[model samples]
Target: MPQIQSELSFNGLSVLYQIAHLLASGKDLELIMSNILEILETSAGMKRGMITILSPNNEELAVDVARGISETDKRKGKYRPGEGITGKVVATGRPVAIPILDAEPTFLDRTGARKGLKHSDLAFLCVPIKSGNVVIGALSTDRVAVQDAVTLEGELRFLEAVSDLIAQVVQTRRRDYDRIHALEKENLELRRSLENKGKPDLMIGNSSSMREVYRQIGQVAPSITTVTIRGETGTGKELVARAIHQKSPCASGPFIAVNCAALPESLLESELFGHEKGSFTGATAKRIGRFEAADNGTLFLDEIGEMSLSAQSRLLRAIQEKEFQRVGGSDSIHVNVRLICATNRDLETDVREGRFREDLYYRINVFTIALPPLRERGADVMLLADYFVKKYSRLHDKNIERISTPAIDMLSAYHWPGNVRELENVIERAVIVSTGNVIEGHDLPPTLQMKDASEQGERNDSFENLVAAYERELIVDALKDTQGNQTEAAKILGTTKRIIQYKITKYNIDFLRFRRGDSTGDDE
Candidate 1:
């Protein structure tokens, strides 16, 4: 029988302490679970940590949170009672430890984490997580195999203690989980309803973040409350405002838009509220402002953060009183207009800095809808890109079919600093410049071609090396497209055949694999 190491016992205490702190932190459940797994790995010498929760029907255990596992594998990591090590532990409400995973016939590696590993050196431990004797889940982990059964037993005990802490957290937060599940179901229903009824144009994503945004929009659209749409520039704040307006009761009336930053301070006031014929030198005639023009409808004030302090004061008055006096006019003109404001600027920061009027900030910020940036929208990029491609194809009268795989990769890898609007522009440009039916990698902007060195794990690489890497990629893509035909690839690249041959040799690209119909360029 082997003994538990003194150092491990000390570390185990620290691990338990940290896990308790994390569980009590009241942070997001997924985040807390991830942090706990990270702590176990770094402190307890555990690897491939996973937390599996019982299904609502108690029919199976599903991987709820995991570390050191692929998302695909995590999805595959499911087990029924008496199925595997994890399953047996949860089924019997007992702890299990296999000193050598390879020796256990019941060690089913559902996650595939141990598929090709030398399992002789691996040990598996699983403990049932219970809420007052009723098993709710299982906490499982892998560590280096120990020679002593007693050491494994000690480790199992330690894991059981950890599982106990986890159970407490699960039991306490059951209400939170239930509430989150309810909200998720509600959001799904709302999304389906929108899909059936036709979603608003420019609101293109179905990501969880975007679903929350849609839910908020739906919650506020029926009312005439002031809405402040906050997001980075090019994130389609105006589109959200329009969606709100279209869904509002005042949909039939005029929907007027104004860019507060586009107009000068001298003209901005006159722009929002009408001016008399002799109001100023530039006021040649009595022109109605956006507020009056948008009467009984929605008025979208874009870049509201850029409005001057004077304009904000007048804006606040109009919002509060539902009336305002135009420039050089004393009569109080009232109109039933619903106001929607959008801004990329940090209004809170501006308020603190005295750059914006605090009273106006509170007035328009009655209901705030935050738009997620394009980079955070995940696979929505592909959806948007496809939409833009078809839109531009029709407008430009091009017969563009689809974007190539390499082009798609470039688009996905690039961090869209300018958000959806930038993606729209990129797709339109790609469609315009694309001569063939398919948009290829070369059709993308030069910025997308050369990736950041740090992102490619070549941070120390020189500028020339980065360019060379992009050049090699282009050459390889061209070769693959032409079926390793050097002459044809040269024609596509607008280069001589000799230069193409030289580049192929210089870059060590396997042109023959392409000829053999193997798109996987292993030689390179």
Candidate 2:
């Protein structure tokens, strides 16, 4: 029986101990593998050491780490199961030793590490790396061919032991990696929930109804569905359309907005579908239509209810076919655009009256988003007012900071008939006329003091009743702002949580109503 020299056996033992220590010390897998290969080359007289791991499907082997190998060679060093000598070891769960590589007909140097060597000087060894009873990968190296077969066999055994150590480390890391991946997925879901709890950027609202709107935006933004936004005029329909476009997959592409109500039937048709040079009277140049311009992006058509029957027919065909021809041009032009339509009119009523096509309405209304008017939105009135105040103040370069209490009262008491647009206009005009940093009640239009004439004599209309109603609205707004967190709401209002709790109980306010989903953000 032949034996490894005492000095070589001691060196091998030392290398194995150090590798085991590195794995135990929690070094990174890539660094440990690289260090292991270096040890084999320097201490064990093995050169060009390589490690390959089996893909999860076990169809091919991929080089995980290697010494004296270029990135180009490493990328090309893939082998199907049982295709090469290294692949055979991993497939059969056995070791392979080629004492004279040139003499072996099956030896294939895929990595090209041994270009000019023959059987007399170069030898190769490959062993399976097994985790328990399953082969997971392989480790291979080249060395000087020894004359005695027993000496080479002993060396192969030592390599097999090293391969086992590598397998153990890989198995442990893979388990840890799977656990971390699951945790990250859970964290992503939590973050999405929190995003829904409040107003996202580019939108303003604290009401639960508007939170639902935000949720809708989140759901629809990632898709290319045709969205029909319905709301009262001036209720920020265009902004909702823009939000959808900015979040969709076509966000990087162009965003084109067309106000269907602003143009005549003839001009609208030409504008939307494009006209060729001299197609009609005054056609000077070939114009690309909205559809072509908005290709690979989003197209927003506002006031869809205002489009004429003649134009609507052409629009329907363009959307359904995803292709159209320029006016006076015969060539078919194809376009890929996400369509968003908005209407303040009751489209269903129009369809019933035979003024709008039912088929066309259904085509664009694949996903409908109904925006609440400012009056029904409750506390969102003051929120929008404050936002407008800050926006115009910055634009007009004013030092305005707060809205006076009396002004807030007038804002809350009177109903806004024209919705958010009316509120924004009122604030812009007030900001211009006000002499002080605070917008006083007198700075507002007199029309606000006399509520709407239509709503006159509808209730008791007492001063005390008005004040109590205003207080309730303020508290409800604060609760919404804090997502029903009573402590945070009190802090925002500069009051104590106990007072907030008392008022909540007395007013029969359900704070949970302000919460959008399964959130424990509110204090019990």
Candidate 3:
């Protein structure tokens, strides 16, 4: 059997392909729609192609895109639902075609675009743009008439297909707008909550040490004073910098940060202060530096102790005089930036050893804030762990609820050499490994399981300690052998099920972890 060809002409197919390419390019939706109208007018034998979008309140249709129509006429074209041929299609969710526009008295020339053309010389085709069975808008185009019903029907079918494509783009843009609107509302709410409570909700802690840090941030955030943050690596110095910037008078300005240790001495000067074109061998174009980019905002210099002595002299001049010349240029540019610096190395020791500039150190050390390590924060560990568990569970799309008691004990007992950053990594990894709602001790890395020599030596033969340790070991072994079956585990241990249940509760063991392919088990 021979296949029948489509009524779409070769030029019409080419125009549709062009419209599809524009959609796939991910250009601005308004520009894409305008180009589609242009293609329909020039190549598809259609004139005055127009796409009208529903207003925000859904009260009327406004011309969003048009071709071969005057600006005045486009502005005049507004239709309510069921008002005319274009409005009727949107109201009824159907397509309409007029073979002879002159005979149709209902063809309201609201746009005045057909002022000189007679009704017998043109045909009108309109289709509803639907999103999931709901008509959101309409697409209409007119063509010069040969006064035949079959030709008008074919053009109507082609226009209907184009309307479907337009509907998809409209729905995608609507969903994206809704998502962004929701996120902006959430951010505003959080900012309002912080202002109402007068607290630094971004940093999570309530310990005495953290309280002092908060006090420092509150004292200096609203001013333009320079700050120097002293702490070990992974102590969240960047977070403190951001909190300061957010609360400062320049909250709406840019915040630029650079690591002094990341670049070599040769490139550090250009990286911080920028350079003029043709200044060096590879300097073919002019560049803007961090100091200039951060003007009217905050500039955070991380690892400041690693800056070279030559760079230190230039940086001191820029800070004290509030100006500096670009590399290989004599023009001094002025800047008004609030500077915040951080370093793990002791700057006082560096000054005494003649490695760092004493004058520069005094200039940047106007105010200092120190952050404590994770091991020193005490109960804050469990709080941070809980926060991280929730964060990673959402990111990984898992159902991890909370850390088990035994796992919390293990986390609190270990000395965090890498500080809070290390703890975050450990929790993130455990969230990935956990199979149920609760994170167990077995889900932790092996390094956390190994007891240090001091801890091992401290476990003396106390009456309660020895009994608890032995009982925990026996229960774990039995549960492992029986594949997490409580009845079989009790029989193997030669004890009643009641005793086994009591022991499991006392030790906080997650027996379901041993079961095969059980990701949704009840936590006991």
Worst 10 residues of 1 by lDDT: 515-524
Off by over 4 Å in 1: 1-202, 453-524
Q: All candidates' lDDT scores?
A: 0.84, 0.83, 0.83
lDDT per residue (tens digit) for residues 439-511 in model 1: 9999999988997765776557656765786787677768766777888888899999889889988988778
Residue 36, model 1: lDDT of: 87
lDDT of model 3 at position 326: 94
lDDT of 3 at 476: 75
Q: Which pairs of residues collide in model 3?
A: 102-119
TM-score of each: 0.50, 0.52, 0.52
Candidate 1 TM-score, C-alpha based: 0.50
Tell me which of candidates 1 and 3 scores higher on lDDT: 1
Ranking by lDDT: 1, 3, 2
In candidate 3, stretches whose alpha carbon ends up further than 4 angstroms from where it belongs are 1-200, 453-524
Q: After superposition, how far is residue 86 of candidate 2 from its true place, in Å?
A: 70
Model 2 Cα lDDT, one tens digit per residue, 254-336:
66789999998889988898988889999977887988878888888999899999889989999999999888888999999
